[model samples]
Target: MPIISVTVGVALLLVLMMVFKLNAFVSLLIVGLFVGVLEGMSPLEAMESVEKGLGGTLGHLTIIIIFGAILGKLMTDSGGAQRIATTLIHSFGEKRVQSAAVITAAIVGIALFFETGVVVLIPLVFTIATAARVPVLYIGMPVIAALITMHGFVPPHPGPTAVASVFGANIGLTMILGIIIAIPAFILGGPVYTKFFKKESLEIEIPKGLFNPKEFKEEELPKFGISLFTALLPVILIALQTIVQIVAPESPIAPVTNFIGDANVALLISVLVAIFTFGLNLGKKMPEIMQSLSEAVSGIALILLIIAAGGAFKQVLIDSHIDKYISDIMAGSTLSPLILTWLIAAILRIAVGSATVAGMTAAGIAAPLVAATGASPELMVLAAGAGSVTFSHVNDAGFWIYKEYFNLTIGQTIKTWSVMVTIISIVGLAGVLILDMFI
Candidate 1:
């Protein structure tokens, strides 16, 4: 009965979102309450579980998401992102433009979320494609692929970072393994696969006013060195702490390093630096900087609500015994935990159409399995992250973003953008499995 309720709960969520066209926040709340009651909990108990989930998830994530958004907004608005793009394009030149586009996108993507990164990098994608005399898809595929991969697999971008918090995965370790997994995924899905795109299909016009680089004067952009440092500062601080903890276990600075190296603290510091470097240092007034920060928070208000709702749904599953029921079922099976984790996330992603929602829900369900089997939380995070991005088609906002940006028909989008993400997913799963062998 509990198992049936679990299946029905997910199906109801999909129908509400995809068929009825209900709001995801309302739909998730409805499904959470419905499933909890069906699973034999009292109605009040179910509601309590939902509230607990909402508070727990938001308590851990609110600050990180807000700080990340502020930094990203500052980076985009102050011309720092354009600075990095310009430098990478010049250094790579026309001959190596493909590699350059991917690198620039990856670096920029790290600091900006997937959607914002796309908005910032689209101009550069078109610019590079025009300069290299290659098809737009040839260059654009690598750029989008790199950004999507980072959004799923890496930290400080919300999805992976939030899942890491839920599963107790070490942020530093997840970042390390995610980078290792992401490089090959990017190469295989981005540049390598791009060679096979039909020449005729690549002939798409750059959409007018889709964030043109010419809008900003070269002198107005920040220097490349400062831009790059500001963008990657959080990653550096976190990685440095990880390395130090491993090598100098008894150092007196451990406490200080741990304090600063904390993901929340590191991002807070980066946000402060960005406010000074991109805002004040660029001669922007205090009011202007404050507006950017406020607007950044406004943009993510819906996303935060959806995340909280998903967390509510997650709590219902955990509290109502669905996670345990599923864990017990898996216990009797011979499947690998990593593969199982990926499959569950992939299924939910296909159903829910939001990678963050799918990843969070899947992590909640898979939590019991990790506890029962003693699986490595880091690999589980990567595996779930990998699944959350698989088969990104019509349901995903990214699919539409790709389609509209490239001016592709639905079929063309499935052939190009969808296929690229499928490749990333497969490559991500394979990487996690391989990593599991040595660890």
Candidate 2:
């Protein structure tokens, strides 16, 4: 009965958001409350759950989200992002530019979260597409594929990070395995799948001035080396932290390393450095830099709100004992733990449209499976991560970002973006399964 009620509540959420054109944030809140009450929580309890969920989610993410936005905005405005794109494009040339996008996105996605990477790279992708005179999907697919793959599979991003914590996965091993899986997933979902889209009509009329490179002289943009370094700082710091802990656990600098390597602190430092390197160092004034930061925050406001609501819905599911429900069912199943973990996460992802929510919620359900099946916790983390990103459609903010950024109609977005993500998901699952056999 509880399972059926949960399913119906999720269905109602979809109907309200899609058919009635209701706001996703409100719909999520409504569904979260409805599900809570259906599961026998008092109305007051449901309300408290929603409030607690919202506060907890936002509290954990607000710093990272805001700082990431600031960094991306400053990078874009100061032409550092453009510098990286231009340098890479010239080096790769028009012929290999699409491949360059995949590599570039992987590098950037390692440092920036998915939303920040997308915002920073959107204009660059369009610029490459226009200059190459190719369909946006040609360049866009590889770029999006790389970003999504990294965001889903890699550490530091919320989904995999939280799942790893829940499942007691080795973060360093998970990162290593994630990169191995991501390579094939990107190739299959991105460049290979792109062949199918190339045959179709791929006309995309971007919004006015969307991809136009800022009016900056050759000397105005940050140098390629510096720009790339700035963008990759977080990854480097985090990597150093991991290395130091492994190599010299009691080193006096461990505390300093931890501080610099903390995700939020890393991003905050990056943003501060960028304000100088991408802004003041390039002659932009304080007010101009502040304006860019303000614009970045405004653009992500809705996305942040939606994520918060998804978190609320996720909390409701956890508090409502769905994890217990799932654990009981899975305990009796004979399926491979890897496949079962992926299935649960994928279903939750489809229902909630938030990868973090899906991964975290599924992690809670699958935690006991780790002990029951004695599966590698790292593989479980990857499996859950893969499922969390399975199919992005109308309910996911990422779907809308791709649709609006590429100026695709609903159908076109599904045909390209949705299909590409599905490919990523399936390939990711396959990669994890294949690795399971050997490892």
Candidate 3:
């Protein structure tokens, strides 16, 4: 029942997950039970703890994740994603493809979940890279970096969303801080990194039956302006809600702010706008649009499950008292809570292979410290988020996705995407720490 033994047990459990290729939910559940038993709970109590942890955590955020997935699917399948990418490319010009790729990924990532954003853009990336005579990694790295940044730091995208929920931080403040850190992370980790790591030009082929680059006949494609608006509507709505809550908390609009600025409502508005701009106005039948939405949702089922399992795993960590133990240890140390959050998240991210899990676990463990120190909860959230996304390796799905999509060998993925994620984590942590000084 020693803390050292408990720490070693948790570490070994994560190793087992990698070695046995165990499902993260099951692995964490087993680990939780073991930790609980070691901490002096009966076996029955340990089992019950798992159930309580999963149920407690999932109750609040599951619906938000499901709705977010559905919205992403709708946007991806209706060609709204394509419209956004094509417009950005034209507006930014070939020389600025890195900037365009980063912006597109960040915007779409905010609208869609991470996996959905990558799947929707992979084909477009191939087409653009071919036309520009550049290495696909030149384009892929920037885009994937942006998606990773948004997925980790932005709201309503599972990682930060779950962190905000766990810590009881203001969702609006989290969203604002997420954006403030995201811009610099994208620039440092995206375009600048892409410039240095540009790879050899190699031809790549899109899979057959995937949407062709030319499928949208010029006449049927929505206007660039309309497509841009559709892509940005949700972000604007959510930002407005956050701004109003912060700047005009006593104003008349504050009472109904949740109704207008709720993440679900904001996304629902975007869905309606997408139906009009990309579906109805484009002459698509309602049935066809509905079909696209259904398929899009189906495509993201695996991702949703992974995220849910991550949530379940996090709940176990909390229930097992592992989080409290770590928080207590950090509280007794000289290290700042901000730095401790980042370090814990970064370590777990490397061990567990999922940024979402790392972020949630770190936040859960760090929440008590934030309370004890009376530090800004917003900064704690940002530090945890940054730490969660610090590194990528063969075990991480995002790393493999980047490797396969860009035809990079493992070494190249390490050099490019892996390094980019590390930079983002460090830069994001620095931003949070600096803000900690002021706040």
Q: What TM-score, over all chains together, does every model reach?
A: 0.97, 0.81, 0.89
**Candidate topping lDDT:** 1
Candidate 3, residues 1-439: lDDT per residue as tens digits? 3466457655865777788888766666677677667777788887777677666667767656666666676566667777788889988999877678778888888878777777788888887887877777778777888898988898878788878876777766788888899889978888777767426533344445654443666777777778778777766777787888778978988767757677767777777878888788988899988887777667655545544555554555566666676667766688888898899889989998888778876775577786666778877888889998898898798888777766667876798878999999999998898777777
Backbone clash pairs for candidate 1 read: none
Instruction: Please state the error at residue 281 of candidate 3 in Å.
Output: 3.6
Q: After superposition, which runs of candidate 1 have C-alpha atoms over 4 Å from their true positions?
A: 209-214
RMSD of each: 1.4, 3.9, 3.0
For model 3 the TM-score comes to 0.89
lDDT of each structure? Answer: 0.88, 0.79, 0.75
Give per-residue CA lDDT, model 2, range 188-271, as digits (tens).
988998887544476567677555444778988899998998887766776677778889979999999878877678778888
- Predict model 2's lDDT versus the native: 0.79
Choose the strongest candidate by TM-score: 1
The window of 10 residues in a row where model 2 has the poorest summed lDDT is 205-214
Candidate 2 off by > 4 Å: 110-137, 154-178, 196-213, 246-252, 318-322, 336-338, 344-384, 393-415, 434-439
Question: Which residue pairs collide, candidate 3?
Answer: none
lDDT of 1 at 217: 85
lDDT for residue 235 in candidate 2, whole number 0-100: 66
lDDT of 3 at 74: 58
